[model samples]
Target: MPNTGTPPLPDTPDNWPVPPPPRQEPDQPEPRPGPNPGPETPDDGVPDVDGPADLPPNPPRVA
Candidate 1:
Protein backbone atom coordinates (compact mmCIF):
# COMPACT_ATOMS: atom_id res chain seq x y z
CA MET A 1 0.00 0.00 0.00
CA PRO A 2 2.70 2.46 -0.98
CA ASN A 3 3.01 2.54 -4.76
CA THR A 4 0.45 3.99 -7.14
CA GLY A 5 2.41 4.46 -10.37
CA THR A 6 0.28 4.30 -13.59
CA PRO A 7 -0.45 7.36 -15.66
CA PRO A 8 1.46 8.12 -18.90
CA LEU A 9 0.06 7.98 -22.46
CA PRO A 10 0.51 11.02 -24.68
CA ASP A 11 2.84 10.74 -27.64
CA THR A 12 0.53 11.43 -30.58
CA PRO A 13 -3.15 11.81 -31.45
CA ASP A 14 -3.09 15.60 -31.46
CA ASN A 15 -1.76 16.65 -28.05
CA TRP A 16 -5.01 15.32 -26.60
CA PRO A 17 -7.18 17.88 -24.77
CA VAL A 18 -9.64 18.98 -27.40
CA PRO A 19 -13.09 18.73 -25.90
CA PRO A 20 -14.63 22.18 -25.87
CA PRO A 21 -16.03 22.75 -29.36
CA PRO A 22 -19.32 20.92 -29.64
CA ARG A 23 -22.45 23.09 -29.70
CA GLN A 24 -23.67 23.29 -33.27
CA GLU A 25 -27.16 24.67 -32.81
CA PRO A 26 -29.37 21.95 -31.39
CA ASP A 27 -31.43 23.33 -28.55
CA GLN A 28 -34.88 22.35 -29.94
CA PRO A 29 -34.96 22.64 -33.72
CA GLU A 30 -34.05 19.82 -36.19
CA PRO A 31 -36.17 16.86 -35.34
CA ARG A 32 -39.18 17.13 -37.60
CA PRO A 33 -38.13 14.25 -39.87
CA GLY A 34 -36.12 11.59 -38.01
CA PRO A 35 -37.81 9.19 -35.66
CA ASN A 36 -38.62 5.58 -36.40
CA PRO A 37 -39.84 3.99 -39.67
CA GLY A 38 -36.31 3.09 -40.70
CA PRO A 39 -35.94 -0.65 -41.10
CA GLU A 40 -38.38 -3.47 -41.96
CA THR A 41 -39.41 -2.71 -45.52
CA PRO A 42 -40.39 -5.94 -47.21
CA ASP A 43 -43.54 -5.45 -49.16
CA ASP A 44 -44.37 -5.86 -52.87
CA GLY A 45 -44.46 -9.68 -52.67
CA VAL A 46 -41.40 -9.67 -50.46
CA PRO A 47 -38.08 -10.95 -51.80
CA ASP A 48 -34.84 -9.24 -51.07
CA VAL A 49 -32.05 -10.93 -49.20
CA ASP A 50 -29.91 -12.45 -51.91
CA GLY A 51 -27.22 -15.18 -51.57
CA PRO A 52 -27.39 -18.42 -49.60
CA ALA A 53 -31.12 -17.80 -49.35
CA ASP A 54 -31.84 -14.89 -51.60
CA LEU A 55 -34.09 -11.94 -50.63
CA PRO A 56 -32.42 -8.60 -50.30
CA PRO A 57 -33.21 -5.78 -52.65
CA ASN A 58 -36.10 -3.58 -51.66
CA PRO A 59 -34.31 -0.48 -50.64
CA PRO A 60 -35.44 2.50 -52.67
CA ARG A 61 -36.94 4.45 -49.81
CA VAL A 62 -37.16 3.12 -46.30
CA ALA A 63 -37.95 6.09 -44.10
Candidate 2:
Protein backbone atom coordinates (compact mmCIF):
# COMPACT_ATOMS: atom_id res chain seq x y z
CA MET A 1 0.00 0.00 0.00
CA PRO A 2 1.20 3.57 -0.72
CA ASN A 3 1.67 6.13 2.07
CA THR A 4 -0.98 8.77 2.62
CA GLY A 5 -0.35 12.10 4.35
CA THR A 6 -2.62 14.69 6.07
CA PRO A 7 -3.65 17.73 4.06
CA PRO A 8 -1.80 21.01 4.78
CA LEU A 9 -3.60 23.92 6.40
CA PRO A 10 -3.96 27.37 4.87
CA ASP A 11 -1.12 29.88 5.40
CA THR A 12 -3.34 32.25 7.44
CA PRO A 13 -6.72 32.24 9.22
CA ASP A 14 -7.91 34.90 6.76
CA ASN A 15 -7.73 32.26 4.04
CA TRP A 16 -10.59 30.35 5.79
CA PRO A 17 -14.11 30.84 4.48
CA VAL A 18 -16.21 33.22 6.63
CA PRO A 19 -19.37 31.97 8.29
CA PRO A 20 -22.76 33.11 7.03
CA PRO A 21 -24.30 36.21 8.56
CA PRO A 22 -26.87 35.86 11.34
CA ARG A 23 -30.56 35.64 10.46
CA GLN A 24 -32.43 38.94 10.19
CA GLU A 25 -35.69 39.70 12.00
CA PRO A 26 -38.74 41.55 10.66
CA ASP A 27 -39.99 44.77 12.30
CA GLN A 28 -41.76 44.08 15.60
CA PRO A 29 -44.99 45.72 16.77
CA GLU A 30 -45.02 48.09 19.78
CA PRO A 31 -45.21 46.27 23.12
CA ARG A 32 -48.57 46.40 24.90
CA PRO A 33 -48.85 47.62 28.49
CA GLY A 34 -49.08 44.95 31.19
CA PRO A 35 -51.85 44.66 33.81
CA ASN A 36 -51.91 47.18 36.73
CA PRO A 37 -53.79 46.69 40.01
CA GLY A 38 -55.76 49.64 41.42
CA PRO A 39 -54.17 49.86 44.89
CA GLU A 40 -50.77 48.99 46.37
CA THR A 41 -50.57 45.42 47.70
CA PRO A 42 -48.58 44.27 50.75
CA ASP A 43 -45.79 41.76 50.34
CA ASP A 44 -46.36 38.17 51.56
CA GLY A 45 -42.81 38.20 53.14
CA VAL A 46 -41.65 35.17 51.16
CA PRO A 47 -37.87 34.73 50.66
CA ASP A 48 -36.61 35.22 47.07
CA VAL A 49 -33.67 32.99 46.05
CA ASP A 50 -32.33 35.45 43.45
CA GLY A 51 -33.58 38.72 44.88
CA PRO A 52 -31.88 41.93 46.16
CA ALA A 53 -30.08 40.27 49.09
CA ASP A 54 -29.14 37.08 47.21
CA LEU A 55 -27.78 38.69 44.03
CA PRO A 56 -25.19 41.44 43.52
CA PRO A 57 -26.25 45.05 43.03
CA ASN A 58 -25.59 44.82 39.29
CA PRO A 59 -26.41 41.17 38.73
CA PRO A 60 -26.70 39.80 35.19
CA ARG A 61 -30.22 39.12 33.94
CA VAL A 62 -29.82 35.87 31.99
CA ALA A 63 -32.58 33.59 30.82
TM-score of each: 0.21, 0.28
User: What is the clash tally of candidate 2?
Assistant: 0
**Model 2: per-residue Cα lDDT over 1-63, one tens digit each:** 554686667689887889999988769976887665444334445434333233334667899
| Shift of residue 7 alpha carbon in model 1, Å | 4.3
For candidate 1, the TM-score is: 0.21
Total backbone clashes of candidate 1, pairs 3 or more residues apart or in separate chains:
7
Whole-model Cα lDDT per candidate?
0.59, 0.58
Model 1 error, position 38 (Å): 63
Among all windows of 10 consecutive residues in model 1, the one with the lowest summed lDDT is 46-55
In model 2, what lDDT does residue 31 have?
A: 86
What clash count goes with each model?
7, 0
Task: Give stretches of model 1 more than 4 Å off.
Answer: 1-3, 22-63
How do the residues 1-63 of candidate 1 rate in per-residue lDDT, one tens digit apiece? 655696667787786777898768967877575455455555545543431324555679967
